[model samples]
Target: MDNEILLRLYSIYQKELYLYLYSLCGERQQAEDLLHETFLKALLALPGGHTNMRAWLYMVARNLFYNQRKKKSREILMGEQEYLSEKQTDKDLLEKILEEEKRRELYRAIRKLEQKKQEIILMQYFSGMSQKEIAAVLHITPENVRVLAYRAKKELKKNMEEFQKKSAGREDTK
Candidate 1:
């Protein structure tokens, strides 16, 4: 495979691959390593050609992440509970804290989802992959992707509602 062609492929898919891996692994360094490793593997394998290069790349990356997880035997998502207590203006600090809290809550809810549903949601929303692209990667019909997405969204909504109720009850107790 020509280096030029490999570079072109990298430029096209690098950002998406990195974001997708990060969403799956939830670690920036691991995601970067996986992105590089995925492209290296692609470079070696691209001579075979592919009917759907983007989907192929996504599958390769996903497989690599899963393999790494299996080898590690245990993977723990890094938590964001250690934000520095820096001095800042009251309003700015308050707003930042609120935003981070909301993001944390959403991530917690996502983590509660089944693995496949989480993959669909992260691929579609976090990595900006189209449903058709996801269908290709997952080897499923586009209609199936839509159906899964609908069900996943419903479940996520229910989980978030439960979280809110629990939070409200906690506040009442306090």
Candidate 2:
């Protein structure tokens, strides 16, 4: 692709792609960097005639994220237990998003999901990707994406109901 076409593609997909990366890494600056790197790599050797350009772009961005994560994993010097516990400290960041009540509750529920389920839910629902697109980006079959999405939605509903019941019980005591 020429510079003009590539820039157009960047403009079209950058926001969602940045969100995808942000959802993976949870750092705005890192996500921005990854988004830029994704397009830079695409500019270098993008294969021609892709049926789903969005999926291709996401795949590239996701691959870049994993690569950066892998390198950081190698560099971690703490013991396994300490390193794992350190990850839990990011929960403070979660508490800061309390301005939106329902969204906060939804995110709390989503946090309880397994990692892949969280990713599937974010990609399919939040990012507006179709099952086929998510499958392509994740390197899974579309059927698998559909099945996971079904299970995730069911789990989210259950969790949200539980939250509602708890909130109601709390109100009764007030």
Q: Which 10 consecutive residues of model 1 have the lowest summed lDDT?
A: 76-85
lDDT tens string, model 1, 77-115? Answer: 844464656677889788988778778888888888888
Report the lDDT tens digits of candidate 2 across residue range 1-174.
799989999999999998888877877788899999999988997888888889999999988988998888843121111113344445654553333556767877888788778889989877999999999988889999999989999999999999999989999999
Candidate 2 deviant stretches above 4 angstroms: 74-99
Clashing pairs in 1: none
Q: Say which candidate scores most in lDDT.
A: 1
How much lDDT does each candidate structure score? 0.86, 0.82
Error in Å for residue 64 of model 1: 0.4
- Listed per model in order, the count of residue pairs whose N, CA or C atoms clash below 3 Å is 0, 0
Specify the highest-TM-score model's number.
Answer: 1
C-alpha RMSD of candidate 1: 1.9
